[model samples]
Target: MRTILYLMILGLGMSCSNTSKKNDGIEMDSEIKDTVTTESLSTSRMEADLKKKGYQTFSYKAGDTTYLMQQYYMVFLKSGPERSQDSTEAAELQKQHLAHLTRLYEEGYTSLTGPMGDDGDLRGIVVFNTATQKEADSLANLDPMVKAGRLVVEVHPWWVAKGGKLK
Candidate 1:
């Protein structure tokens, strides 16, 4: 019976891992966050080298470059203790900002990018279908992190697979 109880508790914990968020004035909590930083100097060099193999790289904007194997949005968020600011106001601000992101996710914007900050703050990345820079910019406007000064959004184009042109 004890073993069964432990198993039940473990299952409950896993099931409750789903994060909750608020959109505009609506609250939601169904999206599990994904945090992966796919950008590194080695990754960048590999991406650049891929172009030489006839894999084309294109700019989402006139000067912007996307180096990921696929397209995604990077997002960052920060709070008081992790931010080392001792500012409750900052924490409150971040919550409201995350709420905005919750709204976007609710609206079906799933490709995400980032480990939001330099330290213990919540950070993660999500990948999705390719979107234009203009589209990204529009997303930025609605993004809670961006609005809260907790995130910076960049539209990066990338190849969908090894040895393939950026889609």
Candidate 2:
């Protein structure tokens, strides 16, 4: 979907890091480590921070690589049964919905959000970086569109690599 693609592009843009120098024919791990350390917290420190914030997280091993998997809540916004609002009211609700999403992003509660390309029952998605599904659901339900019955939300737990980025 276009929404998914848009979120992927946004994520890739945000994840760009400083380029590191190569040593001879190989890239030095230390250089990579240093870059990561400078841009954000170290893995152990990040894990500790997440724990302190009550976020669910775990370390995953795949062959020689280890990844930090963090739990997030994905809220699927669907078309609601109540669609009889006038154009003016609907437009106002849409504006309020966008403002709500912006607030969540600014508050560090959402990582990604966008509408789908099609006009099906599934309207959009919001990836909430909350500690619990209840919190995510509560926040999503606060959206003006949802409150006005223009949209409804179904939330589910999703796990993602802490710093994984799309290429």
Candidate 3:
């Protein structure tokens, strides 16, 4: 009985910790959004910055997958605390955002898709079967997050390993 009680407490503590971390991101994101009180930056400008950084971008032609050709479609999302704190709404939004991913998975357009939130930013990634970067583009367009401004979409090339590949 004592062991069970201790384990239960541990689980509850872990849950609380996770919730706190998630909320922290939401709060921080809100602060960041407020900081950018100037005219909202344009999407094109964001894309330009990524280009300057030489981020892996979508390319049909095979390059150096090992050297740097590895490609993956990605979207970096900046969200406010208001949206982040509302997990119920967030889940709904996630469903809408992943709709295309769900479809593509069945269609075998790619292997896996997921959204990762960290440091007041959300990053979404989708693995593809081959160099066909179109799959990522098509699905990214479908994500409601991209459509809504909760996230920004940037399609890129990615290399896959056995662990990396979903299937």
Candidate 4:
């Protein structure tokens, strides 16, 4: 009687374990299907949105590779902590710096300019609508911040969509 009881318990435990494994496999399959469905939905939505925006699918791409539409200048701003005499001077220089940037924008020299968030060593970036690095460098040096030694700029050539023209 004892041997029979032990065999019955072992069989019952094995059956339960097999059922649990089957349920887990079913759950995993469901999760995989959900993930695939979500990814396909996201991809289709992105393609539709791009079409709605009047952008041609192949305009910036060559097969699987993407290419720049035009060449422009990118200026990276770096902090110059030792250049300021005091806080007031730094503030004043910053004010002048903004004005200088506005002037450049109005003159069609700077296409875009913005400050980076307080996260890294990069202070800001200025995009210039120029074909050569020398011209961009000269223009960037005109900023009051650069003149006051409160900031320094490094210029590089960047190529992107020609559609990125400033209004």
Candidate 4: stretches off by over 4 Å? 1-68, 165-167
Query: Candidate 4 lDDT, tens digit per residue, 1-167?
Result: 99999999999897555432454343335545566567556555654665565433323445433333545789998876557468898888889899999998999888889999895668999998764678889989988888777788898878666455566
lDDT, candidate 4, residue 131?
48
Better TM-score candidate (1, 4): 4
How many clashing residue pairs are found in candidate 3? 8
Which is superior by TM-score, 1 or 2? 2
lDDT of 3 by residue, 1-167 (tens): 99999999999896555432354353234444444432133333533554575534322223212111334444334453344536777788878766766877788666666666555465656665433466556666666766655666566665432223234
lDDT of each: 0.50, 0.88, 0.53, 0.73
Task: Give the clash total for candidate 1.
Answer: 11
Query: Residue 78 CA error for candidate 1 (Å)?
Result: 9.8
Candidate 1 structure quality by residue, lDDT tens digits, 69-103: 54444433333222333478667766776676666
For all candidates, the clash counts are: 11, 0, 8, 0
Q: Name the best candidate (by lDDT).
A: 2
lDDT at 58, model 1: 40
Clashes in predicted model 4:
0
Model 1 lDDT, residue 9, Cα: 99
TM-scores of the models, in the order given = 0.37, 0.75, 0.41, 0.56
- TM-score of predicted structure 2: 0.75
Q: Cα deviation of 107 in candidate 1 (Å)?
A: 1.7
TM-score, candidate 4, is 0.56
